[model samples]
Target: MYKATMKIFSGTDTGIPNYSCKTSGPLAAIIEGLPTELSSQFSSLSRMYHYPQISYMSGNLFMSDTVKFPYFYRTVPSELHLCTGIIKLLKFFSWTWVSIIAADDDSSMRAVQILKDGIEQNGGCIQFIKTFSHSRTIPLEDMVNLYIKTSSANVIILYADKRYTGAIKYMNVLQIPQKVWIITAEWDFLSHYSLGFDDKNNTLTFLKTKKNIPSFYKFVREVNPALFPNDSLTDLWWKDLCTNQCPESIRRSCGSNEISPYFMHCDTIHLGNIYSVYNSVYALAHALHNVVISDSANTTMWSGESQKFLDFLPWKLHHYLKNLHFTNALGEEMRFDENGDLSIGYDIINTVFLPDGTQRNEIVGSFNPYAPLGQDFTINEKAIVWDSEFTQIPPKSKCSPSCLPGFRKLTREREPLCCYDCIPCPEGEVSNQTDMDTCMKCPEDQWPNQKRDACIPKVVIFLSYEEPLGIALTLIYILLFLINAVILGIFIIYQHTPIVKANNRSLSYILLISLMLCFLCSLIFIGRPGKVTCLFRQTVFGITFSISLASVLAKTVTVVIAFHATKPGNKLRKWMDSRFSYFIVLSCSFLQAVFCLFWLFTAPPFPFHNMQSETGTILIECNEGSLIAFYCVLGYLGFLAGISFIVAFLARNLPDSFNEAKYITFSMLVFCSVWVSFIPTYLSTRGKYTVAVETFAILASSAGLLGCMFFPKCYIILLRPDRNIKKFLTKNSK
Candidate 1:
């Protein structure tokens, strides 16, 4: 406790000899690494708490990144936070260009680095050519000469030790009138040399040795006269104590004759250091007291326990000092950071010299106490007369050019920045720089460029027979039909014997041709729409049904003929000739062909209406034409089914081998089953795949006839002697 009091009252050793000893100019507080002034004032009202009462600076001023001391909080926010404030100040001054003047000394150099870093970080420029620095070895005159020769800057920052007074003197000698604005570290406040004040006109006539300290003092006096108040706490305490008794015998020395007039001089003013020292002591005492009391509630207290108390005392003291409303002797708030540096308030005092050699000061502005006044802006960029002040322009950034139709940005700097290189969109894909990660694509109907860099128009519907998929299906169906026709011709030419002929081989030929036509007809309905498609599609469908129906009728008539021919003396027998059945089938086929021709002439096919996919692509289809054909096929299948059922009933009485009608019956059933499904399937399917479904139906029926009926008969002829044509005829003839 005694040690702390000694540190404050013990003068020169703690630095700032003038403020401590009171042998020179007005007292000044030099704060470092903590709250300067305003932060402390705000803290004074924010908090209150109990803490240890001790006589030493017992709390830590050092801070962690996230939290600081409670009682011993900083007035300066932080280095980075201060930089942000500095940037804002620089931008306010509109200083686009400036030069830095840093001292060779470590502390001054650190402050210079901080300012320079802040300037660069804020997108401001600094001209290295105009920067100045003074080495410790350099004399003041030489430094000034170097500064004058290097640049014409109107503003000069002094980042140096208290010895900078020599440099200030030399600068004044170089320029008699104070044309340049000078800014220095707080150390300049301790200078004792006269600033060449002329008391006659109450003005400063030339550059002064004291620089701007006296001006700052005078301004402080005008703003707050209590700063230099007449009453003194120390003097009052001394007088009261001396009168109260003061160890009776010692009171004799305190008499009027023993007391010098110098004793009363102390009553007039209080030194700035007195308040800082007293506050430091009281804060230390308050922290220790709180710790001791807090620890006493939970554990024992001793010198050994003091270390544990030190750990928590800073926080407890912070809670107490945050509401630092205590009045100090200096008439200014006394606050310190965790590092025990004083936090004080200061203002920019713009001083001008008059003819009478006295200086006049006016409050030009307020600034961050931890930062230099003009460090933010260059001298020329600053608003000298207030009206010509900087009109700040907001930062503007323009967006980059969008990707071209085939090209996309590979990597973008930002939304507004140009990408390094444009890449082509890949095939069947597209992209717009949605983010740095990936690009966006167009919908399905749209197709991307070769590189897939961007989207372009895509062909969604088949407009003509020349279209690729339609053309391919057409050529394939045509080639198949031609092969079928050739096979049917071979069957008619080579198998001409009576039984083969009598079975109505020509009708079989016509059936095969009709089936071929049925399969080929699907090509017309493969794609969405075309010019001739709508007009001819329905007529073609009708013909397909008619032809297929005639083939079924031919088989029915042939079946009836063979059955009637089995009975002698029947009236149906004579008319049941194979040639007659052939003629009837030909007539029926011709009649259907004519019906299809008539339909084509009267009511032509037309494009289907109301076709769309989930992806929003419109499809042109054959609607009425398709439905008409669909129903016709169903009707023909129904008719065939009726005939087959009736024939099977009648033939049930005949021998199984002689009739061989079960195979024919099964074939009819398959035909009916397949085509019956065609109607619903055709009506349900959309556009092109609908045609494939109908084609599938026809192929199924054809496969059933070829495999189930003809296959067995052919197997018997090829594999068995009993069913062999030559063997059967030879045995019967014998």
Candidate 2:
């Protein structure tokens, strides 16, 4: 250690008057090679003199501690970022089921816990983690074949130094022929290697990003003893001597791996990681320039006095190295991070072994931990070539298959989250994407499609005049209306006849007009239910039917009064006037009109969309704002019909000639039966059929009243006019 230190620096030499000491001893140390056991020793020794020691290769994980090695820096990134890059790479290919085979050495063992936590945290399963003994060939072969060769894990992450070729020397993953391996640059196959056919295929390597150092390849190819006979590197490769034993005038050319060191000529060689050492020289040069260069013409570093030469002091050189930044010949930024490491990432190489024993490292992807989230890791999967040992291209390494759309993932018991089963989505819900845990529900007015992956709009429907049901009901209502009109005409033409004069003739005319209005009210229920129609339809039905029933009650009362007044000395004669019967009709009809007005002003019906009443359709119907008010209106009409029926039935056997009480009773019975059944039928029906039922009730009851009360009178006036005189009337009145 002391001899090496003396060759690197002269601690006591300050170059006061002697210029030969200017370029000697430790201004700074450029430590090269991989991170090894000696790096810590060198780092500790370098820190004693306070010299800045910088390395270009990613080194020991423990070297990153500032307290232990504060002056240590590297151009390559730390080993911690390599673990992160491996995690991102595994996720990119969905290789969730994998194995970790590392060397039983400090460098590989340091990353075991980090890799375990990363793999498990991301829903991945680790079949096993084994540290193979590279020192014992027998144990190494058994452990590799026992745990990895027979296991189901297809992808193996091999972590070790490139110099240690233990388990992966033959790609012996659990002895599995179809295994894929992802090895680090420390196990670099980019250099010279003689492997079994198909051994390099299905293998990937994380190589440090490299740029062509100008003239580096040319210098390696053209290097000879004539160019630099004093340098040890050129002297070892080139020899131009004729030995006395073999007469070396018979020229000999030698390859890199030849056993004999003596050679007349040299072949080209691969320069691995030489670029990093070249960058190391540039780092030292830039640090010295800051201390040497001057902005002013007369203030150059050479012109400074001895006191200003303090910049060359060991500790003083560290300040410039700590904050050094520059661009290299390839236009790549070169700088050290706060932890004294370059923040460079890795390039993914798809190692391809050709048929003729040649090899190639195809750069198919990159992993940059310092990059933004989505752009950090990327791979061109199609560019990867598979090994002949595998039966498929881009081999699968998953615990379970993916769940298809319209299905949800159901995790298996006592298994990792990656192992799961797929279950179909429930009714009225959908899963539009694969691997969803929960399903979504459609809106109120929509329904799920057949695949349950989408929602479709519902069909909107109403009671329209264009449908078959509406057409038939329309023709029936209009025909009944015409029949009523024909009866009213017959009554007008037979105004002077005795049959027409019976049963309170004016009450008959009022009842006929109101019945016509009831028929027209049914038309309101047949068309598309709108705000104006829905508001007034039920009210109109209530008022018009009330008047018709009220007129019937008046006729029954008038017949009873006419009979009672015929008794001698009966006081009912005063109450038997036609005005008294008109008063009863007016008072009963007015009460119904008042109730209808109260209902309209309080809680009126309105058009509503009944979505729940049907599936995949919207039923446009009237919504009774208040159920109590709706029932009250029907009850009032029922009350009038009930009273009218009782009064007419009691007076059915009164003077048959002038009494139309029996016919009035039958009409009231029909009207009462039609509306009483309408309540349950209308409530139970759905869609446009409900409106049809109510319209049918209106037309049926109005036709009953018109046919029963007026059709017989037309028959008597037209078919038997001989009995129309007062003498015939007196005979019929008995």
Which candidate achieves the best TM-score against the true structure? 2
lDDT of each: 0.45, 0.74
Backbone clash count for every predicted candidate, in the order shown: 42, 7
Give residue 695's error in model 1 in angstroms.
2.1
Query: Tell me, what's the RMSD of every candidate?
Result: 20.0, 6.6
lDDT of 1 by residue, 1-734 (tens): 22332233334445431233534421111122222232333223222221212211111112312133233333322333333444454556444344455445444455567667776665444443222333332444565557544543322344333344444554553242222323442333221222332221111111111112223333322343234545665334334323422324222224453343333222112212333334555555554455456667888768776556654554555455544444344454455444433343233444444456444444444444444655532222231232112132221111223356456556445421222356665544566443222455666556555655556655455433667655765676676567566656555654653323434666666666766766566666665666587665545654554555555555665666666666767777777656776675666556555656655665555664432432334355555544454455346546655675567545544432434355567777787788777778876876556656765665566656544444554445445535545434223221
Residue runs of model 1 more than 4 Å from their true location after superposition: 1-458, 461-490, 525-529, 533-538, 578-603, 607-611, 614-620, 625-630, 641-653, 656-660, 706-734
Q: TM-score for all predictions?
A: 0.36, 0.78
Candidate 2 has an lDDT of: 0.74
